[model samples]
Target: MSFQAYLDNIQAKTGKSPSDFKALAEKMGFTLNGKIKPDVKATQITDWLKAEFDLGHGHAMAVYALLKGKKPD
Candidate 1:
């Protein structure tokens, strides 16, 4: 899946748009355009997804990939 595909998948699976998640992440200091730093980890993203949207590992991975400009293959 492409980055856009991942984002679309996330929305489809969780009923939440990527922009919605982006807002939530920003509130938590996970800026999408911020410098690449080690402060944020995949686990944090996973936890956030699970806690906020009831997303499982697969869905969370899709969200993470979209956030990081990656696309699942």
Candidate 2:
């Protein structure tokens, strides 16, 4: 499935929007400092992405895009 598909599936499963996921991530220990900083490792995001959405890398990134507030095409 495509990235957008993964994100859509996440919403369907959790009934939570990307914004909501972001909030939850913060609660769980994700520091969204903006700009994908060097300190911001992909694994940190990927771990939560995997756990929350049961998605692989590609799909996780799609969800990440949405969390970043970028509408995927």
Q: What is the lDDT of every predicted structure here?
A: 0.72, 0.66
Best lDDT among the predictions, by candidate number: 1
Model 1 CA deviation exceeding 4 Å by range: 1-9, 32-37, 71-73
Candidate 2 off by > 4 Å: 1-4, 32-38
What's the lDDT for residue 66 in model 2?
62
Weakest 10 consecutive residues of candidate 2 by summed lDDT: 29-38
User: How well is each residue in 4-46 modelled by candidate 2, as lDDT tens digits?
Assistant: 6666776887687777766765665554533344465667888
lDDT of 1 at 14: 75
| TM-score (all chains, Cα) for each model | 0.68, 0.61
lDDT, model 1:
0.72
Candidate 1 per-residue C-alpha lDDT over 1-73 given as tens digits, one digit per residue, 9 for 90 to 100 = 5657666777887778866776677777876463223688988888988888888787788777666765435
